[model samples]
Target: MKVSIDTDRCRGFGVCVSLCPEVFTLTDYGYSEVSVDEVPADLEGAVSEAIAACPEHAIETL
Candidate 1:
């Protein structure tokens, strides 16, 4: 699975980062960003949780 973060919608809540550090991270400017090119099999569940937990609904699957 692939995921991308919508910077404009992200509020830097850090929910995604906390749920899955392997796939998501907070940028220097304090925003969520996708750290991986593709979601690993083992991390897909965590990534999905992050997507659901994100208040801004910034994470998207591709």
Candidate 2:
């Protein structure tokens, strides 16, 4: 699965980063961004958690 973060909807929350450091990261400005183009099988669960935990609902599978 591929994931993308909607920056406009992001609130600089660190939930995604905390849940899936391998795929999601906090930008220099503090918003969350996707670091990987595709989600690895081993990390898909973590990414799903991040998506569900994101308060802004900014993360989505593409």
Candidate 3:
């Protein structure tokens, strides 16, 4: 699956980074930033958890 982050809606909570560090990182802006467009097979579960943990609902799976 592909992961997308809506920066406008992000609150820089770091939930995504905590849940899926392999797929996401905190930018200098303090919001979570995507490292890759598509998630690797091994990281899918973590990514899903990250999406669920996002309080701002900024992450979307496509």
Candidate 4:
């Protein structure tokens, strides 16, 4: 699976970070940032949950 975050739509809620710290982090500007554009096989479930929990709907999976 591939994941992408829309930085403009992100609110830095940290939900994704809490759910999947391995893949997400908080930027200095206070927005949620993806550590990588592509989701690794082992982290698919966590990443999917993060996508679902995103309040701003800034995460997309492909």
Q: In lDDT terms, which candidate is top?
A: 1
Tens digit of per-residue lDDT, candidate 3, span 1-62: 99889989999989899888999999998988899978999999899888888999999887
Worst 10 residues of 4 by lDDT: 30-39
Instruction: Give the Å shift of residue 50 in candidate 1.
Output: 0.4
Any idea what lDDT model 1 has? 0.92
lDDT of 2 by residue, 1-62 (tens): 99998888999979999988999888889988888877999999999999899998999898
Candidates in descending lDDT order? 1, 3, 2, 4
Candidate 1 has its poorest 10 consecutive residues by lDDT at 31-40
Indicate the TM-score of model 1.
0.96
lDDT string for model 1 (2-48, tens) is 99988889999899999999888888999988888989899999999
lDDT of each: 0.92, 0.90, 0.90, 0.89
Candidate with more favorable, higher TM-score: 2 or 3: 2
Model 3 segments more than 4 A misplaced: none
| TM-score for each candidate, following the candidate numbering | 0.96, 0.96, 0.93, 0.89
In candidate 2 the C-alpha lDDT for residue 14 amounts to 93
Per-residue lDDT for 44 in model 2? 91
Best by TM-score: 1
